[model samples]
Target: MFDLDLWREIFQSINKNKTRAALSGFTVAFAIMLFTILFGIANGLENTFEKFFLTTADNALTIRSGTTSKPYKGLQIGRLITYANKDLDYLKKEFGDKIQYITPKLSRTYQLKYKKRKGEYTITGVSPDHQYLEKAVIIKGRFINERDVKNKDKVIAIGRLVEKDLFVKESALGKYIDLEGVVYKVVGVFSDNGGDEQERTIYTGYTTIQRLYLATDEIGSITIGYNPNMSADQALVLVQEITAKLKSRYDVAPNDQRAVRIGNRILQEKKRLDNMTTGLGILIPIIGFGTLIAGILGISNIMIFIVKERTKEIGIRKALGASPRSIVSIILLESILITAFAGYVGLLIGVGVLEAIGSSIERYWITNPSVKPSIVYTATIVLVIAGAIAGFLPAKKASKIKPIVALRNG
Candidate 1:
């Protein structure tokens, strides 16, 4: 099993055609390297995209009422949709602590003024929990609190853009801003310096705005934040149950003409992104494995050719009382050595490249595209399997060769 002479002979054969052997080994190595690199980069890109999405309230779920599609029981299908404050109350009572944070929002565009300085702005009426839901960064003073909603305080939190336009170098905190001749205190300023700031949006307590601006006890929409441990499917089921109860209490049809609208856009988007990442991860390996198979085929073919060309030498060994199994083992060992050594070299090169380029690549969904140790270990296992497969057929053929026929060819 441990014949020194057989190993020496196998080495001698490979050393004689160093260029050919090197080329075959390199082919396998390069394929595996390329496969690892491509997949790693794809993962990095996905990471960056996910980060961008998260910065804008990753966990927020909005429920916007949409017009009914079909006329139910001869009633008009195109009725204006609305959800009342009572509906929110009902949902709050039913779900309780199952819902982490909930808020009703009413958004409208209006001209905002601080003395002579006036600008068009989007006003949002939201509860104190809206601050937690959006993770809104307050640059100055404080956000709307429970007291503001209770007292119906005409207080507002202005975006950074509004401060730049109206206040200029003046301090924004505790300053009064006019909304349609009604004065409201600027309790906070947001550091949203992008297009969100430039649009000059204002946030106020939801109940305050509902009393002042909107005449009805209805809300424009509801925002909800579910418990992190709950799956999207679980949340959806809860929401559906709440909707059913609300419909029954309101004396509305199951497929109600006045049904409340609810949606989890964040959950849907997150699921899509996850699926995409998983697909890319799986696809890259499959393609890489194909390349590895190609390299193995090349190695196998060359080994077969080596066996055929060395027929005379093999026949002489058999004539000298070398067993068939020994001949097969010698050839198989040579094939495995070539494959494993070349594969290691290739893996090192690929990993080095990833290390070099990882930091330079822009942050994506798959940040820092480096090969994991597990991945390398997996590749090593693949190399071993490929090496064995490459050697097997050639070794089998060499074992079948008779001493007489092989010696005559020589």
Candidate 2:
């Protein structure tokens, strides 16, 4: 297998025609490098979307009440669709297993005050699962628990902006705060990606809000978490069913689509992701293989020229009884070595370029933008297979070179 003579001949051929050899190698290398970078760009976009979507629960949906837009069953068209504690209970009991976590939202206006600092924020009433819907990170203390909701605890989880504005330099943990002249202890200081306004928001227990402030069953909206494994179609179905149930209970006309507003963000987002994936599926191959096929064609053409140039010499070898298989192997070995070496060079350049800008890309574009080892290995395998295909026709054509044909061509 250690064919020194074959390698020596290969090198001799390259040395004889340096320009042609460089062109051949450069074609392969450029193709690999360009293709690799394009692949990285595709994957980086994918990573960027994944990071953004992960900020919110993949299966989370928010529902808001709306007024009837059409008259039905003796009801006026302007009937307001309202959701309350009992509505949540009814939905929970009706769609028990289908619903993962359902939380009612009742926005309360409070003059947020701690010591001398005071700010006004719409304190939202939420359950423990509200954290999942909002994806808040608790930096100081724990999020709301079931006990806090059930026992009507006078506690709150304020966002980072709230912490900074009200508490200033001091920590807000275990600190008593006033909301609308009522004292409540801060249990957690959280942060979200939703900018300064979102950070200014705070969470209070649903029961506490209803009992202490509103003194009535009044809810502005509801958030429902679907099972993580639910597909876009399934989520759409659930939303339709829930919307129908709510419309029926509230006596909104069946045809009044505006009475019950549903937001299937998970399904919408999933569909968008699927569309993006499909577009990339069509794009990547068209671009990557387009470059690769150019390289392959160049390799094939170069090999054909090499075979043609060596016609007289090959004829002499055939005269000496050299086997056709030897001729085919010789041409194939040279093609493989050229393509493999070019690919390796391209691999180094591609990796170096990515390493240089990886951090900058991740900071702004994607969370982590890097090619996987499997992708590199797959490229290598492609190089080998492409090398074989590039050399195949030339090798076969050269192999069929009868002494007369070679002599005549010469």
Candidate 3:
């Protein structure tokens, strides 16, 4: 039920003691504001983790060859180690059960020409499975298939940006683009969430690039998608196994870290993300509880002080036939009204701050810092309820005080 008289009295009291009202409101507002900013930053950190590490398939690993740093057998240090087609075949034959999809990549840069429009773009020769390893989404036509690799076809899959740059408003599918001197037909157009640079690359068959450029079986690197079902421990063991075998095959020293490098290591990265996420899970609640506790204490203390100041007023009301329940309701309602309004104001300010600073915080790995309004709304309700409860103690105590005693004290 709406109590117009009671609300009128509350507003009158608040107007009379503007300083007290402002101080109480500031306490609740600051707590909620801090709470909002803390959670928003935590969420932003999570978003950063996802965007940074999820660019490639979680189960993928990349193998790159480098010059040896240690001598083994008769080979001297600084010997350049390289991978060939036979290495891919060797892995398939030896660890076929552990491997899901595997592909070799040969990367180069070439000037692409369509009519008079020309732009330099990265060209990567990859097997069909490279599409999955790179997590490329085919927006049009199809990705490179085994037939293209086997037949060394000159068909290419261009990135979304590449298509936009060379073909303009027209679709690039089925159109022939001249790469330097060799012309290749565009069979597919794809997009990548890895951003513009990734979407600017062009993909073709590994064999085609090998035949035209290197004229050898040499590959730039090998990308493998391990079985997703493999546990982290199993993945680690598989990495060790692959590393040992590859080093042995190349006759590099066992500890020759420079000769063979394994990148991606998503399992390890994921474990770190998991740990950090768990820490955040623990952190958010602590922040909420801390803010709530501070707000409760602040509201409770102010309510006590307000009741002290209003002792003579309360006694006069009681002498004039005011009920004990009315005395408590006035204080409790005042606290709740102030708390609810301040919390909402704090939420809006926090959201505004997040929006204003979102662009500038990318360097800190915080992206899209924000809190759901509903969550803050729910928190505000909780704070109001808590404020009511906190004010109840002092209100109840004042209601029980004898009118003569309160009047004397005031």
Report, for every candidate in turn, its global Cα lDDT versus the true structure: 0.75, 0.80, 0.89
Locate the minimum summed-lDDT window of 10 residues in model 1: 191-200
- What order do you get sorting by TM-score, best first? 3, 2, 1
lDDT of model 3, residue 138: 98
Deviation (Å) of 227 in candidate 3: 7.0
Candidate 2 clashing pairs, residues 3+ apart or interchain:
none
Model 2 gets an lDDT of 0.80
Candidate 1: lDDT of 338?
A: 76
Q: Cα miss at 293, model 3 (Å)?
A: 1.8
Best by lDDT: 3
For residues 72-121, what per-residue lDDT tens digits would candidate 3 score against the true structure? 89889998889999999999998988999999999998898999899999
Error of 1 at 316 (Å): 22
| lDDT per residue (tens digit) for residues 1-410 in model 1 | 67788789879978997986787677667866775787667767676656656444555677767565556565666665677777677778888877788888888888888878998888899888887777677989998898997888999998887898999999899999888878899999986523564336899988877888787778888887777667656766766876777555644468763455666666777667656767877887787777767766766677667777778888998999988888878777777777778777777888888878888766434577866656755765676676666666766777678899889986
**lDDT for residue 391 in candidate 3, whole number 0-100:** 79
Assess every candidate by TM-score.
0.61, 0.78, 0.79
- The reply for model 2, stretches above 4 Å from the true place, is 1-13, 44-48, 51-55, 69-71, 265-273, 286-294, 307-337, 344-377, 388-410
- Give the per-residue lDDT of model 2 (tens digit) for 1-410: 79888788778877887886787788778877877777777788788777767666777788898988988888778878787888888988988877888888888677877888897987988999889788888999988889999998999999998888888899999999988778999999999876777788889888889899778777878888887677677888898898888888888877787889988766687878867877987998799888777766777777778777777767877888988877777777777777788887887787777777777877656445566656755665576677777667766777678888787887
